[model samples]
Target: MIDFWLAAGLLLLVALSFLLIPVLRGRRAQLEEDRTALNVALYQERVAELQTQQQEGVLDAVQMDAGRAEAARELLADTEGVAAPRVSRLGKPLPLLAAILVPVLGLGLYLHFGASDKVELTREFAQAPQSMEEMTRRLERAVAAQPDSAEGLYFLGRTYMAQDRPADAAKIFERTVNLAGRQPELLGQWAQAQYFADGKKWSDKIQSLTDEALKADPKEVTSLGLLGIAAFEAERYQDAIDYWNRLLVQLPPDDNSRSALQGGITRATEKLQASGGKVAQAPAAKVAALLKVHVDLAAELKDKVKPGDSVFIFARATSGPPAPLAAKRLTVADLPVTVELGDADAMMPQLKLSNFPEVQLVARISRAGQPTAGEWVGRSQPLASSTTVPQRLIIDSPDK
Candidate 1:
């Protein structure tokens, strides 16, 4: 922020210099005009003396004529260096007043409309915070600087939850959902925060939030975990075990959270048996379709494209929503590499290649990181969702 202010001050000084230079030049011009007038007055006085001497017969006509010629020469020599005064329709006072107001008006306008707070926020975020409390403070300032930013609000809400400030987290998450739409993940986050803020008491609002999130994505991990926790607290051990078992199915094999969730299920099972309740075990997980694909850039565009550009490869349903079922991101430099798209890579739990009867493969190259709009694209005809053959796609055409 100090550096930014210094640079801004330097620019203001440069602008002031442009305004003051003309006024300073006008002063120098006035000095030249005064010097010319002084010289002319001296020449007039000398001529008056010459005329008096002639009138009194102290000098002859030829001597008077020589005196007049010498006086005229001396006057010409004295005034020759003076330049013509420039005409200024805007006189001295106006320029001086403008010079004063320029900086004042600039500072006023900048204070009213400039992004100084955002500038400071950007500089603050450039470095890592030494503590979580510091991080939360920075995020709070960032959200204040950009009140309409959903991403910043969401992160701030998460920070509040991390700090055990559930009441604040609930408010922030509700605002986030309002701005970003009630997506499953955001809804789940809001529900969890609200539940905790209400002293772990379940209410219609929290229930509605969780139900809505699950309705959109049944395997929303946060909602599942929160429901399991709520069920356990209510002494409904079987329900807790069931909710956790469902969550366990959605986690990746190598996920660190899987072990903890499994431990919770084990504890729930013991509690259920001790309470004389029957425990129904959850069914084994089903593996979704895994499609292998090879992506390549067109030979003609090899030199025209940047190597750092983003490339998105995905499979979308042929007869459903526009969102990709499973997607992967890579760079142009990673082209010709093979990638696997499966339920494991699902962008959402409810959307997977196996859930769609027919799917199309798409690969897009975008410099701006937008998946839908890009410079180049490649697509495959509708294929069976369970297709076992490896597919090859070349980005050989414009996106339009």
Candidate 2:
């Protein structure tokens, strides 16, 4: 920040020089004019002295004339090379006043309209913060600098939540939603913050927010976690277990949060059993639909493709969204491989194999490694998602 201000000050000085230099030059011109005027007066006085000496008979006409000529020559020498005085419609005071006002007005307007606060905020964020409080202060300033910045507001809300200031977090999250639209992640955050801000009390507003988020994306991690927490707090252990288990599947196998989530599930199970209630299992776990596929390249086209070309096998709903419900990627070198696609292999939680009644199976060979568009493609007729039969796919036809 110091460096930035120093650079700004240097630039301001450069600009000021442009305004001040002209006024300084004008002063020098005035000084030259004054000296020229003094020389002219001295020349006139010397001429008058010569004329008086001739009238008193102290000198002859030739001597007098020679003296006058010498005086004229001296005057010419003194005034030589001096420029004619220029008339300025705007005299000394106006230029001097403008020189002073140029910098002052420039600075004033810049302070009123420039992004100095944003510049300072950027500098502050470049350094590692000393503490959470310092970091919060920086975020606050950032949000203030750009009130419409949804990303900044989102992070600031999270920071407030970490600081246990739920009310502040709720307000920030609400503003973020308003600016960025009701995205599932933001809606979840707003609901959780609002829930905590209301002293852990449940309200229709919070419920509505959570419902809308989950409906849009069942795999919304924040909404799932918040729902689990809310249910656990309300002593609905079975509900908590169900929500947490669904969330657990969405996490990667090696995620650090897996152990914590599993522990939560275990706790919820124990609580449910203690209350003489059976723990409900997730429905998807009971009858998960699995489709087995054997993929191979047609003999006629085998020589046309390289061994390293990519192969994509997927299932999509016949009459639903175009996005694949389950998909897998392999290479042409792995042809004649048997693979399985199931609910566990769903591309998105909301678009699982079990959610669709019927789907079409497809296998594509792509030299460019693209999944949707490929070099050669094959597809199976629509079949029940729960079919246990193994289907065969041959990549024989050129993709349209």
**Candidate 2 residue 91 C-alpha distance from true site, Å:** 1.1
Instruction: For model 2, state the Cα shift of residue 313 in Å.
Output: 11
Backbone N/Cα/C clashes per model: 0, 0
| Cα lDDT tens digits for candidate 1, 1-400 | 7888799889999998988899998899999899888988988898899989999999889998899899889889988978899999988898789888988998899989999989888887999999999999899999988999999999999999999999999999999999998888999999999999999999999999999987666678899999999999999998899899888878889999999999999999999999898898566655579999999988999997898999999999886657999999999999888999998888987688876778899999999999989999999999988989999999999999
- Cα lDDT tens digits, model 2, 237-312, are 9889888988998888899999999999899899889889997656755477899999988999988999999999
Candidate 2 segments whose C-alpha is farther than 4 A from its true place:
56-74, 254-256, 284-400
Instruction: TM-score for candidate 2, please give it.
Output: 0.71
Candidate 1 backbone collisions, by pair: none
By TM-score, who's the top model here? 1
> Per-residue error at 362 for model 1, in Å?
7.0
Question: How high is the lDDT of residue 257 in model 1?
Answer: 97
Please provide TM-scores, in order, for all candidate models, with all chains considered together. 0.76, 0.71
